[model samples]
Target chain A: MDQSRRFTQVPGKYFLIMKIKLELFGASRDLSNKDFLELNLKNKSSIKDLREKIINYVDQKFKGNENLRKIIETSAFCSEDNNIISENYQIDKDQKIGIIPPIGGG
Target chain B: MLHTKIVDLSKEKIKPENAEEFIASSKFGASIVFYGTVRENNENKKVTGITYDSHDDLVIKSFKEIYNEADQKLNIKEKSVYIEHVKGYVGLGEISIIIAVACPHRSEAYDLSRYIIEEIKKRSPIWKKEHYENKESEWLKGNPIQAN
Candidate 1:
């Protein structure tokens, strides 16, 4: 049940045009009301860049949902299983990252 | 060198007894079993049921990662440890998660079991939606929602 939807953003410095899918779950999904969103960004975008872009992206689309904005603010990024991401972590155009939303697991 | 006996995300009821049986052995004198269940009340509101969700593939991956780390970090790497969580609807008083650990000595087993559950909480990708008896549901985790 996966289909790609491209989100258009202004071209950044690294204009290599990479397509990365966002996999969301937990509180993130509950608040955002989305299962997934695709990011088509500069080729070698950092995790920090993606985070800001998500904020800007969501702000544009979900301006009314403050909770989801807060969730995006607190969410963590992972390229694969349990990869604790740092702000400096770079995402290749081919990489897919999962967003772990704000709520803690019990 | 604690070998992981089980790391699962099952949609069935979590049976603590099964975990007890898995850790039952003469070689291990100490064992610890912990169960997390759906209680009937939260903050004085009736919690009818809970629906647990997971990033299925990531949940197992995270569990294996935690299991492997526990096996090495605690020096009980070769001991027996099992962890499981339910993936679907679980009613009140029903078990949702279980952890069983055993070692030749009592202390290590207790310590390891404690470590596993805490890690699972901090690292696992599991999420639970609280369903109130009045039909209010929430996924925000911890904050109780008022039923209309």
Candidate 2:
């Protein structure tokens, strides 16, 4: 977990930006070709924001992979404690979050 | 005793007997063992092997959760369980997972075993990539994790 600071414009004021590390798995890893991704997000960003950021990142980097984007949309985020975090859950500190895609195991 | 492991093929392999031995108990009359294996073909494709990928820590955690759920839901008593899933390449006819359960009676033993496996499939953070004889591999589509 690491944090970096930046300034991003909000509706009336500027918000602090923080760096969050996302540990990718399965199809997300295959598409991104990276085990992890460092994303800059607004301080105290929600999981929804992270989802949007990831989808946006893929939309730009992969250019035309609709399926990959769809996978990210349905995927869920897991906390360091191995519990799935709700979309409304806010992130206020640095954490290594895991991106879990659809699972097929016995 | 509850035994759970994510067997890494490079270092070790899953043994069904080990699961059986762990769950064997004199207090239980019925013991059910389930072994999931890789087949030779799928959807008319010639399959060679399968590579299993998993979030190691989450997987073990999920297994414990499933076991606890099974114990309470099924009202199992004097029960013992053993669960092991593979984490690497498994060729055709090789064991990919093992689930063993021992309960006071046959009915609960069956129920507990089924519940554990089904829950694991839905809750565990694991994926399977199938390798075909055509030298092609594809990740099998699975149910997405529920994000509340």
Candidate 3:
């Protein structure tokens, strides 16, 4: 699913935090060594926001790994329909999203 | 028959005969079949195998899109195409992908086959990690995905 329905109360603000599921593929999967990653962000975030979070995550967890960071930066997010979503597209609900890196197939 | 498939090697192997049989017809004069297999060496590395990973649903969607794009670009309405790519580990000399096409002319068949494969390489969400003799592996670089 894209985001978990369970929301958390922000300490200062009243907005809920959404838990999102990002499916990894190709180099992204290889670098992360995971099939998918769960991210928590503010409700109604956009694909661009997700990208930043992923970059930050890679930076913190895989420090000095420029290759992984570059892959995440160059990647695009895909919706459940398998179409690449625009960076401005909002992610307000639960759904499984895919992180598409560069592709090489015969 | 015009189709695309993301084959799971553990469940079934890709067969050339199946593609040939599916594309066989009296109306078509030429058929082109391309099979990609694991090689023994690449970039000076003694390659042992390849692990192909893919987003199944997206790969199938990309295949359909590539086929449709091919049809529009080539203006070939009447054709038969069968495309399959493996989705798991493949050893040396094992088949990784197959693209079979049948058309009214040899040149069209060749062009169509070439176009489809090229587009799939750029559009499909599939990746390959090469396993080498030294037990090391690396994912090959590819074209970046563009937001649709």
Q: Of the candidates shown, which would achieve the greatest TM-score relative to the real structure?
A: 3
lDDT (tens digit, per residue) of candidate 3 on B83-132: 99999999999899999999999989999999988888888889998999
- How would you encode candidate 2's per-residue C-alpha lDDT over B6-104 as one tens digit per residue? 999999868777887898779889999999999998899999999998999999988888877765787675789998999889999999999998988
What clash pairs does model 3 have?
A: A1-A95, A1-A96, A2-A95, A2-A96
Model 1 chain A, poorest ten-residue lDDT window?
A1-10
Write candidate 1's Cα lDDT for A50-83 as tens digits.
Answer: 8888888777877737876776777777776446
Find the 10 residues in a row with the least total lDDT in model 2 chain B. B69-78
Candidates' C-alpha lDDT: 0.69, 0.87, 0.86
Stretches off by above 4 angstroms in model 2 are A1-14
Which CAPRI tier for candidate 3? high
Q: First chain of model 1: TM-score? A: 0.75
DockQ of each: 0.28, 0.73, 0.83
User: What digit string (tens of lDDT, one per residue) describes model 3 on residues A19-92?
Assistant: 78899888888545578898878879999899889888987888848999888888878998778899999988
lDDT of 2 at A61: 86
lDDT per residue as tens, model 2, A1-106: 2222467677888877777889988777875567799998878999999999988888788884788888888999999887899999898877889999999987
Query: Candidate 2 or 3, higher DockQ?
Result: 3
- For residues B21-54, write the lDDT of model 1, one tens digit per residue: 8878888788888888888987788899877777
